[model samples]
Target: MAIEKIMGTETELGISAKDPRGFDPVSGSILLINAHRPIAEVKSIWDYTGENPLLDARGFEVSGERERPSQQDNRTINKLLRNGGRLYVDGAHPEYSTPECTNARDVVCYEKAGERIFELCLASANLSLPERQQIFIYKNNSDGKGNSYGHHENYLVDRRVPFDQIVQGLAPFLVTRLIFAGAGKVGVENGGERCDFQISQRADFFETFIGLDTMAKRPIINTRDEPHAD
Candidate 1:
């Protein structure tokens, strides 16, 4: 029998601050997440006891220091939502991850909810600041510069399937789906072809066919095997 496919989405929202002294995205992200009011009191902290991003699905562990933020910073940067979701800061962007869903409709519903949550957070965050230093958030994937953030999709697959076979099957679909599914961008970046506009905002940043790095040298099919569940 085939395993059931559980799906979810993780979006890293673009953050900016209207400050004359320039902006710090990390600080802005921290403020944005901290401004949201949870459905109930946040009694427990987010557990990171089992997360190991270096563990690759290709059957090997990469050498690197896993990011473990200080408890104080973690408390300030993370928010648990009532809709079984998470709001937090990922790198320089405020990110939200919807709870695992069994269908596409619920996934999209939760993703849209995340945007509204950010809007409320943005309003609350701006109230505490001067009019000139207010913060803003964008739902897009790129910053229009060389930097690109992520809007990752997750699907629970059968562990019995070969990893190589999975990549081979998914790569073609992922590459070609941009023709219809792309978000559409105004201009190009990363020194790729000079076009007035492009279908996908992230296509220029893809350099490798497969890898584990999300920030740089991004892969078409990432191999990070940190499943949040057992």
Candidate 2:
């Protein structure tokens, strides 16, 4: 069956930007929203490293309140896959260990707690001007105890601007914003401490979501009284 052929789905709805609603149908940029209720955490039973569950490493439960995301990234990706959808990996979300992404063109890491993450590509052959999809999955490294992670979002600016300038310009704007996917830690940096973040940065997004790539991958920490929005 043609993927374009509409399939009746209660959980699915398509919209043309030119419709009566103010949604813009521009080909260059489009936002595909997953309206489904996202899980608060990823529960798992397998222990990847057979290490003692009581190991006190740098990422060992930062706080008793559970400092990291509890949900495993694979589960979220698997769910999207079952729904016939995928995500983008790029430099924005890279593998753990050598977290820094040399490809300036790809998305990158700024901050991370587990120092590990998973990457995926939902869009076909990079982002085209017309329509494309990109999904990024961040999995908190787990040796068993309580863990955490976030499904951060990245917008590929296809405009013809210098990557360095873009990185500098986008940072300030991003530091002040949050994503609708959900709330999580944010920062700016090329690869903060390796796979421990989205974009290595000098500051963190405090309590707000969305980290600016001001310093390439580092994110500033934001703290304010503004009513939070998810």
What TM-score fits each model? 0.96, 0.22
Instruction: Return the number of clashes found in candidate 1.
Output: 0
Candidate 2 — worst ten consecutive residues by lDDT sum? 5-14
lDDT of 2 by residue, 18-123 (tens): 2324434222111222122333422332222332323222223222221222346333222232222232222222222222232423223222211221211213
Alpha-carbon shift of residue 13 in model 2 (angstroms): 25
Candidate 2 residue 211 C-alpha distance from true site, Å:
13
Candidate 2 residue runs with Cα over 4 Å from true position? 1-84, 87-148, 178-230
lDDT of each: 0.88, 0.28
Candidate 1 whole-model C-alpha lDDT, 0 to 1? 0.88
The top-ranked prediction according to TM-score is 1
Per-residue lDDT for 42-147 in model 1, tens only? 6667777788989999999999998787888778888877788899988888999999999999999999999899889899999999988998788888888788
